[model samples]
Target: MRHTLKTLLLCLLLPSAQVLAEEVQVAVAANFTAPMQVIAAAFEQDTGHQVKASFGSTGQLYAQITHGAPFDVFLAADDSTPAKLESEGATLGGSRFTYATGALALWSAQPDLVDHSGAVLRSDRFQHLAIANPKTAPYGMAATQVMAAQGLLEQLTPRLVEGQSIGQAYQFVASGNAELGFVALSQVYRDGQLSNGSAWLVPAELHDPIHQDAVILSKAAANPAATALVDYLRGERAAKIIRSFGYQL
Candidate 1:
């Protein structure tokens, strides 16, 4: 009876060990937090592989990866980060792919404060505008482009309160630190609809496309869990979820 019990215990332990070995560590862009969380859950459910995630500004993540962060994959807010990693041989060649195109939105906590026609930008209805720090966040780059396209950059510069990441930028507006701010649309969407606040979806013509990309890190290229994650992101299911988050395919 003792021998039989030991055999059954070993059988159970073996599969648990295999499962533990299949886990992957992902470093994701802060802007991608919402969708990445949803996808990570689905990925684990479908594949029985765990995902450990860390979120931060893409620039910060780039610095960490360069210094040998143990992230198995990188989901960047822009293509440039992945490209840089690839050029530096930090990422597996040919594993880089544009996963989504992010959109910029001018949002306000007050219901009618943001004019879809972008007239509020010129109206001087409010005193402050917030945006992510262009030096670190891709959305900030797009925000600057939108401001410049509308000829508001110089005028708005003084009123601008810079957030280190898109999440912080959203907080500035939500907290009324700024009457209006440029933020990712995904941040304000809930249950397939825009939140109670008003927003203007900036036209793509206002800026270069915010192409978000993913790549398997060179250190994890041979890791089954890492490779699986890259493949999972490219799969149809993941793409659909990404699109639902207001990102373009």
Candidate 2:
């Protein structure tokens, strides 16, 4: 312990001193899993801070947070969650900000399966259609809203397969367990284009805008690493990664 203290003191006195590494626990929405992983890597490289991320549906994470889970930051799939946390005094005052605006996609691993216009929904083409649980995932709510706007939710209800989170919903389609699924556009897109299979980008008008927000938890309000992580999330470096995944910055 003395030797460690001496090293820290020496470093503090040195001209080329490095900051001590700090770890932050972040609760992330499932839809942002890919980008968050990439961002966490970049953040650690840029700063000597470590990030411990937990991914789940926004509602699930929010519940855990309200129940005193020791998460330092909350990255929700919907803006509402952050606002609710703020209202409930779970987060630092005025710490919320929209990090990304998400878009939905009708994705299928089969080529030429989902037409761009989504007319395939009317036809009896596939057996299973997957969606995340609407009660938990905001993307699932958007998916149902899109179907309702297209007047196909009732017809499609009988064939629906539900996943616990948006990431799982994507898995169901990617693994071919379901023929087609309502997934975040980011899951199927990379470098400004669809990465694989067939996908129909859902029209923004069909559902409300998915404004994902981030907030620093009150429990971590004084933690430098936690604040840095939240700041890094809204920075250009992370924003670029987010856009590459097809999420709106």
Candidate 3:
């Protein structure tokens, strides 16, 4: 009789638990796509909350938010965008935090095309090099910074190809439209190693730190799932997943 009663209570409570689960709409920076995908899966499994992420360049995403896109949470590639949103009162106060530090990598689809020291940039072997648009992508800005620091920006300018976002820039290289390109280290790296192709991990000293931040938008101030997702990102499990994709916590 007790077993039957317990089984009946379990059946009654299961539907309530399912009903309590909520979905969070997230705007994520393109560079974080892989790790976010992994993290989102884990978050959903653990908390029963669903994450729906839209990926794009940070600047583009910020523009959408300012134009009233209905995103509950934003994970940006740079700290500035989130700060800008906060200053504009578009974000929930005290709900912002750095989630990752991004690194730049010069990548080529061909193996051994890029050397560890990135000497290929100074060479004339490649006709075109791709970079994301500096105006909208933090990685693209960092790529320019790296070139400038190496005194190759002016010389390489003629050979440059621009992409709307880092993902597109990477695609340019992968598709051989550009022989090489600057991309997020996370995109080419996984599990402590390069996933494929050849890459030169740009030294962090060549550019300003790319500190990625996450924030809860004002539109999601009342969203429990939004808050929960943000909290989950700060946890060790999420940190581990972020690190696996070559991002610094």
Candidate 4:
């Protein structure tokens, strides 16, 4: 212990000293899983800090937070969650920001199963259509809105398969448990192209905009690593990764 202390002291005194790295605990929305993983890797490389993340539906994470979970930061699937946290004094003042704007997509693992105009929903070509649980996921709510706009909500409700989170909804399609699913555009798109199968980008006009926001929890208000992670997310480096996954800045 003495030797370790001595090394720290010497490093502190040296001009070329490196700051001690810290680990930030982050609760992330499931729809952002892929991009956030990439961002976390880049953040650790650039800042020499560690990020430990947990991914779930925004509502699930929010519930855990309100129940005294020890998360340092939160990246929610909707702006409302963070705003509510801030209003309830659970977040650091002035530390909230929109990190990304998300878009919904109707995706299928089979390349030709979905069509350009999303007309497949009207046909009897499939038995199950998957969606995230609207009570827990914002993307699921958007999916419902799109269906209602098309005047198919009541008709499609009985055939619907509900996943607890967007990631699970995506898996339902990927695994063929459902023929198609509503998911984050980012899940099926990367580098300005479709990463797999087929997708119809849900027109933004069909649903309310999905503005995802990030915040530093009051529990981590004094943690430099938490602050650094938030800063790293707002940097150009992270923005590029986000855009690659089809999220809007």
Clashing pairs in 3: none
lDDT: worst 10-residue window of model 2? 13-22
lDDT of 1: 0.90
List TM-score per model, in order: 0.90, 0.91, 0.91, 0.91
lDDT of each: 0.90, 0.92, 0.94, 0.93
lDDT string for model 1 (1-249, tens) is 999999999999999877757889999988889999999999999998899999888998999999989999999999999999999998888999998899888999999998877889988798889998899999999999999988989998989998998888999999988999999888887656787689998898999999999999998866799989888998999988888878888
Can you tell me which runs of candidate 3 are displaced by over 4 Å? 1-21
Candidate 4: clashing residue pairs, number: 0
The TM-score between candidate 2 and the true structure equals 0.91
Q: Residues 89-134, candidate 3, lDDT per residue (tens digit)?
A: 9999999999999999999999989999999998998999999999
Candidate 4 lDDT over 28-62, as tens digits, reads 99999999999999998998898899999999999
Query: How many residue pairs clash in all the candidates, one count each?
Result: 0, 0, 0, 0
Off by over 4 Å in 2: 1-21
Overall local distance difference test of candidate 4: 0.93
Residue by residue across 49-122, what tens digits does model 2's lDDT show? 98999999999999899999989999999999899999988889989999999999999999989999998888
